[model samples]
Target: MAGDTPRAQPPPPDPDPGGHHPHLLFWRWRRNPLRRRTDRLHAWIALGLLLAVPAVAAAAMLAVGDTAYRHYRSAAEHEARTRDHRAAVLVHDAPRHPEPGSDEAKKARYPVEVRFPGPGGETRTGKTDVEPGLPADSTVLVWVDSAGEITDPPLTAEQIRSRTMGWAILAFLGVAVMGLAAHGITGLVLQRRNLAGWEAAWAVTAPRWCRLP
Candidate 1:
């Protein structure tokens, strides 16, 4: 029995059954009979999206942010030019009611009548919201336009900056969402095509491999 040669052992099982290393990037671009045209197209699409999404998002954010900042700053400057702060005296006591100590309550205002000097040096009376519980004849500062009408204070530099940042963030998020959606849709279409191709190839080869009588 010792005279017979031992049978040769089969080669060890391949760690990567597909013959492609797991660490390899862009393996679909490699020349292989198993790789299909759709595989290359999918790889190219993924590569383009990887490089394009961030660039497009940054551009959109900058463009929208610049436009918003300019518009807000111009409006604020115009308001500052046409409006002025003047001392006003309350005509009647401001009505007060009990409220919780919350941010909403802190910012709450009540309507009260006040008299202030007009642009022509004459006294003008108007209704405006002010802190509650103020006694009659209390002096307060109010913003008035050229026509002596009570108006809101002009936007500050901080407000303009915040508005610009908000718009920029929105633009960035919008572009990111669109890019992700496009990539997902393309992946689905390519996957379907790949499945169809595999099924057709298998249909042609199955009969040859299984020879019927």
Candidate 2:
């Protein structure tokens, strides 16, 4: 018997029969007596809300986006009401060909002197931007308020859609940021709670686990 080779011993089983192994990854969900009610609550939160994080964030984004777009549309409509489309005559001749160095050459629009009717039907003159290449006295449709002050042109359908989409994206990003913040805070809270739980558990179990038989 002494000359026989020793048989290979099986690995020791985990001391906590309810837990999977020495490493306690899911010890809270295991059927262990040491697991507290708070442990179950935290476990359920991690499990039940794992998919909900993105879903809630997306829903929040949609709600905020709808509100933002409605406000934007209302403002745009108000602007349209305050502004009128009317023709203004150019007082100075437009360049036949703007120099490449000019902003007009790149943008194809130019600020030039123009005269138009005021609210009182009197001629009013001011420098306003226009599309390039129109000669002097050329009548160009522009947006003007009742005060005869130049204003931004009304939003085209494309412009409205673009603005709506831009605002929606911004809203979506904002919600996503808030969602991420919430997830981070929840993680920190869970981490602290889990650390405290481990400390409490170790206080009771460490002596047994570490004692030499």
lDDT of every predicted structure (CA atoms): 0.83, 0.71
Off by over 4 Å in 2: 1-42, 95-107, 196-213
Where does candidate 1 have its weakest 10-residue lDDT segment?
6-15
Error of 2 at 152 (Å): 1.2
Please list the residue runs of candidate 1 whose C-alpha ends up more than 4 Å from where it truly belongs after superposition.
Answer: 1-35, 97-108, 117-126, 202-212
On a 0 to 1 TM-score scale, where does candidate 1 land against the true structure?
0.71
Tell me the tens digit of each residue's lDDT in model 1 across 1-213.
433333333222223435377655556778876667876887798789879999999999999999999999999999999998999999999877477466676777899999999999999999889887789999999999988899999999999999999999999999999988998898678767777766676667655655645
Per-residue alpha-carbon lDDT of candidate 2 for residues 1-213, written as tens digits (9 for 90 to 100): 433333333222224534456577577678876565666676677665556766776777677667767877887788888899778999988765547558757677778989988888888887778766778999987789867888887667677777777777776677667756765677567657666766666667656655655
Please give the RMSD to the true structure for each candidate, in Å. Answer: 10.1, 9.8
